[model samples]
Target: MPELLNSRVETCFQQAEAFFNRPFKRAQVSLKLRGQKAGVAHLHENLLRFNPQLYRENREDFLKQTVAHEVAHLVAHQLFGDSIAPHGEEWQLIMRGVYELPPLRCHNYAVKRRSVTRYIYRCPCDGSDFAFSAQRHGLVHQGRRYLCRRCRHTLVFSGETRVE
Candidate 1:
């Protein structure tokens, strides 16, 4: 599986190199990624991380789409620099023109999410409750305010918390 993934990544890089008319260094692939993300491209480090579980479950799609998707990120960064958006026109162009693949922003794999504690916040408009993760909850503690999109009102803690 690893060898196949490596080969696919190399093939993508070769396509990118030929299309962009520049040498692209081979990117390091790691299967250390967990959770929902199928893969991530660390542009600055020229590294790609793939979720082993997701890859094993969806091997063909992961190879054909996900590999090209991530490689496009690196190729786009190298050709257009960091000023361009991560999934901007440059990336879409590479996916369509170079690899002839769709420029999909995310994978649709069914991933199991680990249960975590959630902090509940409420919107003033209609008392709709919103659950926030620990990271966002901490950000709120540090005086960061989040607004409710529908109501256009600031979120306030409802003194509720849950673990599920």
Candidate 2:
């Protein structure tokens, strides 16, 4: 079924073929590339990445639009060159004119949100409190200090907050 998505990309590549009247290589779909984003296209690498989480949640759109979206980026890069702006006229043309898909800048998939534990910290200067993500909290627990940009004072961990 993954290959089915690649076939969709090949269909999009063929559209680029007719549009530019030149050869366009097919883009491959990668499930291993994880990100908060729904998809990404590496024009130089000839690769397309779909967030596996997004893929699982919205397989229909993932197949229908995500492949075409990323393929349009590659086709736009081939026609317009690296200096061209991403999601500019060239990409939009391939997206809308060629693929017949909406020239949307991003997707609206419902990705799963993980519960995060935040550490609350305060600066002594003004008694202002700030929340730190788990990664930042780990750094603080490792004896790293974060300074307040406004007060120029080291922020100390005051408490913890769980975000769901």
Candidate 3:
């Protein structure tokens, strides 16, 4: 990561902790330069993704605001569970009281959205297809290779495929 990008990621985590009045011990922050339409708060796998282009274009103001936005979601879920409304009154209060951000509003950026691609694999002998979350897919020998249970054939990881 570039210096600016690393700084932004660290700053976002720091701001989030300060705003929540509680430190997030195990949370991880990451940047995705092209996944804006995927939303700002992706909580699965304990990761948060911020659009680098959006942060760069807006600089400090946008960085602080979005960090608050995503942190609100994380805090809310940790407290009240994931079924709660993402941007409801509880979230709004956290944004204000904890983060000291202005009143919440639906904010959108005009950046061009890019499609995410996933990798696909197949078993050469049995013709079983396997889909993976990452673009670069490979199989390691130390671990048990995902075999076609039905055909007992070794799986081969293929290449990336555009989903969009």
Candidate 4:
């Protein structure tokens, strides 16, 4: 599987080089990623990290979209430098024009539910609730304001927690 992923990544780099008429460094690949994300690209390190569990569950999508997505990040960074957004116009161009794939920001693979403690938050509109992970809850303490997607209102801590 790793060899296949490496081949897919190299193929994308080759495609990008041909499309842009320039050479791109081969990205280092790892299967160390975990949690909800399908993959991530470390632009500075020229690294691609894939969620091995997710890949095992959604093999085809991982090979097709995930590989291209991470490669596009490395390609865009090598071309446009670090000032551009992670999924900005440059990355989108690489995805569409170079790889000929949709510039999808996220994957829809079914993720395994992990045991986690969730901090409860509430939105004023309709008084809907949200469960925030400890990391995000800590960010809120550091002055990160979270908004409810459905109501578009600020989420306030309900002073509750859940273990699941």
Which pairs clash in model 3? Answer: none
What is the per-residue lDDT of model 1 for residues 1-164, given as tens digits with 9 covering 90 to 100? 48999999999999988887889988889999998899999999999999999999999999999999999999898888989999999999999999999899999998988889999999999999899999999999999999999977899999999999
Ten residues in a row with the worst lDDT in model 1?
Answer: 17-26
- Candidate 2 whole-model C-alpha lDDT, 0 to 1: 0.82
Could you give the candidate ranking by lDDT, starting with the highest?
Answer: 1, 4, 2, 3
- Among these predictions, the greatest TM-score belongs to 2
Number of the candidate with higher lDDT, 1 or 4: 1
Give the Cα lDDT of each candidate: 0.93, 0.82, 0.63, 0.91
What is the alpha-carbon lDDT for the whole of candidate 4? 0.91
Please list the residue runs of candidate 3 whose C-alpha ends up more than 4 Å from where it truly belongs after superposition: 2-22, 33-39, 103-105, 113-164
Question: What TM-score does model 4 achieve against the real structure?
Answer: 0.71
Residue 123, candidate 3: C-alpha displacement in angstroms: 37
Candidate 2: list runs displaced more than 4 Å.
33-36, 122-129, 147-154, 158-161
Ranked candidates (TM-score, high to low): 2, 4, 1, 3
Count clashing pairs, candidate 3: 0
List, residue by residue over 112-136, the lDDT tens digit for candidate 4: 7989999999999887878999999
What is residue 113's positional error in candidate 1, in angstroms? 2.0
